[model samples]
Target: MTTVRGTIRSTNTIPADGHGDDQSTARARAVDGLELTGYDVVQTNTLSSTAAGNITVRAVARSTEIQPHEASGPNYGAARAAYLQTIPDGWISLGITVNA
Candidate 1:
């Protein structure tokens, strides 16, 4: 199986009326180095910090990762399309890195 890593954080902003964004304030929380072994999440190391006192969080849209196949098909395009449909609405990638 192949593994990948990404960081996830909330984009929600918590407005504080009485609180402040001073040195003691916690603005944002992120899970860095979150490893994904296929569809299974293996690691979730947390990293917390703030930027510009705005609870800034950086992220990308959903991503797709195609698993490795052990079987061969005559028409890869047709088979791939049909197989891709089985995946629910989410990330859908086309290829992978094979290590020999």
Candidate 2:
């Protein structure tokens, strides 16, 4: 419950649209973006959807750390919004997961 160093792989992936050259690169960006959005990303992976063209990104990440600073102020919301801004066109949010 409250003592969770236990973050799940809720990493949201940006679409491949001009974000990176390949899946590996995109995954790297996912890690960076997650961190920028206020997550201490521990592990990362990618999943491709069964859906058709241009919708091929699913970033999986687990946040192993949650700082005390995250308990107040704007938290990840404002930072997350800024991070989302960096995502190029055609890449909608796959979404984010709070510590579970």
Candidate 3:
């Protein structure tokens, strides 16, 4: 089994329409080492916005370690579920405060 842990931070400009550039923020952080050992980041809190100042996301990631041979169809499914189950479905941004 392999265990992975990391921190993720997302930031974006707040938009009036409630749409912000969360994609770039997530992408940037993804490479920072938030991705799990045997899993990948399917999505980030992008659809949500920091329309007020800046969209910020901070999460402490923890994932179970699965072996390659052990990763059968059912195991893969369980992994997927375990990963997706942690993230929130939707988020509502109120405001943001930019720094620097």
Candidate 4:
């Protein structure tokens, strides 16, 4: 089994109207997408700051077959490719951890 834990941090400027619901929705969609790709999400931690217009989401996902890899030089190319394809646009991968 392999465990992949990571913090995905993003900052979006709140509109003048202060409608940040869309940002929240986007974050949810990103997590959902990961689940759809066959990872089981074990835990999630979210933090948002209205004053700073910043949002940080941390999720831990586990998979029996998939292995984690370093972003600089990924040993599991297919896993990395799947992750890249799964993540929604506009969301950045801030950090990742893999445990076997």
| RMSD to truth, every model | 11.1, 13.7, 17.3, 13.5
Lowest summed lDDT window (length 10), candidate 1: 11-20
TM-scores of the models, in the given order? 0.28, 0.27, 0.26, 0.30
Question: What are the per-residue Cα lDDT tens digits for candidate 4 across 1-100?
Answer: 3444454433221211112344565356446545434445655555554555555454555542333333322345554555555555444566666654
Cα displacement (angstroms), candidate 1, residue 4, comes to 20
Q: Which parts of model 1 are misplaced by more than 4 Å?
A: 1-20, 28-73, 94-100
What TM-score does candidate 4 reach?
0.30
User: In candidate 3, what are the lDDT values of residues 1-100, reduced to their tens digit?
Assistant: 3222222223222211122256455446543545455434344443344556344443333333332211112344554444334433332122222211
Candidate ordering by lDDT (highest first): 4, 2, 3, 1
Least well predicted 10-residue stretch by lDDT in candidate 3:
91-100
User: How many residue-pair clashes does candidate 1 contain?
Assistant: 0
CA lDDT of 14 in candidate 4?
22
lDDT of 3 at 12: 21
Candidate 3 vs 4: which has more lDDT: 4
lDDT, candidate 3, equals 0.35
lDDT scores for all predictions?
A: 0.31, 0.39, 0.35, 0.46
The residue-level lDDT of candidate 4 at 37 comes to 47
| 34: Cα error in model 1, Å | 13
